[model samples]
Target: MIRGCGRLLTMRTAHRVETVRAAEAALMTRLPEGALMQRAAAGLAAACFSLLGKGRVYGARVVLLVGSGDNGGDALYAGARLARRGAGVTAVLLGDRAHEGGLAALRAAGGRVEADDPFAPLATADLVLDGITGIGGRGGLRPDAVPVARAARGSDAVVVAVDLPSGVDADTGEVTGEALRADVTVTFGTYKPGLLVDPARSYAGALRLVDIGLGDELPGVPDLEALQHQDVARLLPVPGAESDKYRRGVVGVVAGSARYPGAAVLAVEGALRGGAGAVRYVGGAADAVIAAHPETLVHPGPPDRAGRVQAWVVGPGLGDEPGVAEVLASDVPVLVDADGLRGLDPALVRARSAPTVLTPHAGEAAALLDATREEVEAGRLAAVRELAGRYGATVLLKGSTTLVCGAGAAGAVRVNPTGTGWLATAGSGDVLSGLAGSLLAAGLRPVDAASCAAYLHGLAARRASEGRGPVTAGEVAGTLGEAWRDVRAGE
Candidate 1:
């Protein structure tokens, strides 16, 4: 198994490439270029055949979208391998100078150069190999390639992108123009950034990285990371026999109001389910909080009087209450969310002595950064990191793919893979804040707590829904126990 498959699986494509390059450099001294390409071709052919089930390769029409770079070569060579097995493979050249050796190899193996009209062959092929671009390609699909990409999208055949979806930026996960949406992306050597980050990620579905035997050369650290089940399990706070409520940690929650008391209930539910030793609730909705989870210690007073909490979860349904200022002012690891983020002073957040974590959806994040919602959405990584640096806190920007970044931790942004679009429903974020706050109280660092909670929260949401339909905030909290078990079991 890969040394850290569980952990490394979450790393950005650039880091994976570094590993690939290092491995290649060490092994290149012994292996020829043709040998490496053969290995890659073998792997790609095997994967494609597996996807094809029991279907015979002979007489199966395959279309290859060839480009100028080696990505096109991978496709062409793979086309040769398939042709040898009796498949009718056709290469559609997209660039002027195609990979000469690969094109010759394909022709020698009986693969033909079909009509260059990109759209025609796509309508009938059993499978389509998108070799228009690779990790080296920048920007979106070339103008001539867009209509062809659309035609492929409309087809029923499985679309396999070589390396990554063409036109998607490899390093930044940005899509400049039209990109091919592949059913499976057969990436060579290692993963690219576009495969993990959104907009670009959406295009590269079911990614599989083919090893060209480049393993020994990667760098020590990656640019971005994704946490796996085992990683989260190892990082989770498990109390010992001697651990007491005080020792385990206390989380003070300042949330809700008379108007939206349900937010308080959900937040408290999240905190209790989050494995905190004790959850102290301080806000106007103490009655409602108590009614929901009597286990929570409710205090009907200012946040300052909440009495000794290791961490604080503020702003869930706070409704512009004056006491929220007091909660924000406290010298504790704080998680600011929801209404607590509205019209807040950045200077006050910066003045805090303790670590702070801001959890914001797109709109809330936009408001805090003084940028339009579209700007934040366009540059999620830049927006979150900017907020973390400006406030000297941890920022957990919540969306389809949540991002966790520390103010000063260089190259330490963590992208969450566990969440689903179904989590976009109301009151889900409050549960997240509570769960994150509970972990913070239980002694995990701000980024760790936030990211771990997000991973679990998303997993729980997934479990609760079971792919059927919408789930309630309460269902998410209720499913945390099973999620925790699955994480512990290393599932």
Candidate 2:
């Protein structure tokens, strides 16, 4: 339950399991034998001490769920450090054989091993260390350890996981079976995909990185990255002194029908607040959009006739609109979202020379991929990558954890860490499409526009809600300027 201001705001880079192993091996060769494990143990112990509060380490009841290999060894060594500080530490071994050196160190530090009634100590425990599995463990917890994991969860102890929670896929972030949920996970070297991507990400409550000095050993391009406030600030467009409305950029909106005019209003709201100098509105909802935002330049014809825009945002609530094809034909960057995603031609998107962005929810993505919604949600990373490759466009897969993959699906996928549950309201995606389209018009690359838009959209939602209740799409749009200022302040 240790909270901090830096965790969510910092740029997080996650490497795959194979990459992590290679980095650890390279670093281990340079360091002395057992030195790496000692470093991990020291960091783990310090994190646990902080969680236990000042002057609370002594006489605290601590239980360690130890398993085989280095994961258990890290826990055992950390537990020994706590035991030496006068804490009542107990280890419940769940694997066939434990690390010998770690076991010896714990016994010497006056920490006792529990063979009988392991569940009894958990009832009164103040802290529980989950070392039953590491990043290598997959397909869920073993049958033998299921009961113990449940008991640990049922207890009032603040559970801390070593490396990562057991039974979760480290690379895919998929929890196939039963897994242990941790209040805090202390990882070494670098972040794993499981710590950032959902299903597995939800299980890892709060993440703390313990630097074991593996920076140079890792690869230059990470598997995944999360944008920080400073990163967003750097990407945001700043208007020059001589910049005019057209010089900044103009984003055209081809959205809404007679029935869903609010969608048009919301999209226009987002575009006006986005980095673009001006927002152009087309389609049947021009009256509604103009009534809400008088600053918009309205057009009564198709997007091509809407007079020169740098980018077009199409398909927010067009029930039976015939503008998707027209918008796709334009040379400017186009953002296809909501109704625009329905029956979108991959060939048309691929043939375009300019950049294209597809923003789809799980259902729309499932439709595009011809897969079930459950499949898309379960394997969001694979879904987004496959979609990007198929359409040759930058894809933004929106969910509890938003993911953005660059065109061709070749580089590191950017994961947005600022999203809150309150952003699930209707018309929010429309706002996001407008915002991202505005960035595209402002001359940002496809990936940069999409990721920066998501960062701002999610941040605005968080600000509007203030962690108290639900937030409307209009409120989120209204708060965009505040979020933009907040990001710039970090720089």
Candidate 3:
């Protein structure tokens, strides 16, 4: 399921263009020629009819921004369905050629085909269907279609994209050039990467997947997976009757400097609620951590001086710290973040006997990859995968769409669907690192720990921000229990 927020949701599996095409080809061979298109058209029309509200289809002004391929055909056929229901449907053919049969169907349904200025029909249009380019069309929209695309955006009508939005890479979620932004995207068969990963994900406002009977033909593994509440709930650790604090798990946190004592406190705060039995704080901010969390065991200097810990979360606000190497040397899962991520040696991380997870924002990731922050943000999926491969760790690239890519597992990347804008506040990454580290200590795999931590962290941010305007890092930490309970609700 494409799980998001605090509940179970639809299948969030996304496929690449080639995978989708192969599945479609197989499905088409078993069905009638135009049957697939008809199924898609029916779903699209039903979605639009719902979007326009009850009794609004009759006399509603609908405009189709049609191009050449099946994407345009889907729009045309859906437009025909609207026309048959008494809507004033108009198809503005942007390409030189149109889908002949789709055009005929629209004409038969009394829909007008506009070959002249497309702007006139858009003025009073109640709905604009973007069908300019499909999954195969790349490098953005052609120069000829720019003005018309702008007009559609400027219109008061609800802009709906057919399949993938025009100008976005279906496989990579990259918007290389000018593209159309839609209010809602009605995708056929399955979800595409562009619809889930940002910056292309932002272009696809709200996603609606239409099952066109291709589920059976798609492969067992998908390109991406977004965890639902149930998935996260299943991964969370539950204590046994005989379990003790150490027996449960101990999370080691090496964070905060004298200048950033609050970071240690915040990290410990998150760790306490992250299903771990105990937290061990080893850094410069021991006093602050003790003051904030009296239950935490504190150490003043090096990490080896501290008691045993199942996992270590090193680096949030640790300005010029020396414990990263010491922490990495231990035979335990290590989560490196913020200051620890600075000047991290890939060979050192790669040689670790235990699993490692790296959580970096766009800027840190860009620095690590020797690329610009803009480039990392533009192509997050690629950046995260590359970081995982290079570091030999499960990399969690945090941004608008937080992604987790496991080392040596190139097939499926986990996309955190619970992320919110409010989680971008200061010390948030610190909280996330500690939480993930706690999960790791609780025996979750590096990938599962990272994914579940991100999921709960985002969900906690949402819970903290609800009816509260903006939320602080501490507030997000305070709400972790509530978010955990929300995920485990009804279980």
| Best candidate according to lDDT | 2
Name the lDDT value of residue 412 in candidate 2.
91
Better of 1 and 2 by lDDT: 2
lDDT minimum window of 10 residues, candidate 3: 1-10
What value of lDDT does candidate 3 attain over all alpha carbons? 0.90
| Residue-wise C-alpha lDDT for candidate 2, range 213-314, written one tens digit per residue | 999999988999999987777778888778889988999999999999999999989899988989999888988998899999998877899899999999
- What's the CA RMSD for each of the models? 3.4, 4.0, 2.9
For candidate 3, lDDT tens digit of each residue in 382-425?
99999999989899999999999998546689899996898889
- Clashes by residue pair, model 2: none
TM-score of 3: 0.97
- The 0-to-1 C-alpha lDDT of every candidate, in the order given, reads 0.83, 0.92, 0.90
The parts of candidate 3 lying over 4 Å away from their true place are 1-11
Q: Across residues 1-491, which tens digit of lDDT does each residue of candidate 1 receive? A: 00111333433434544445566677778987678777887888887887776666778889998888878888999999999988889888888778888999999999999764666777788999898986767778888878878887789889999888998877667777788999998877667656777777888899888887665555555667788887888778887778788888899998898898989999989999887889999888888888889889988777787689999999999897666678777888999999988887878888889888999998998998889987787677778888888778899999876888886545657888897777888999999999999998888878889988999999999999896879988999899989999998988
Name the candidate, 2 or 3, with the larger lDDT value. Answer: 2
**Which ranges of candidate 1 are over 4 A from the true structure?**
1-31
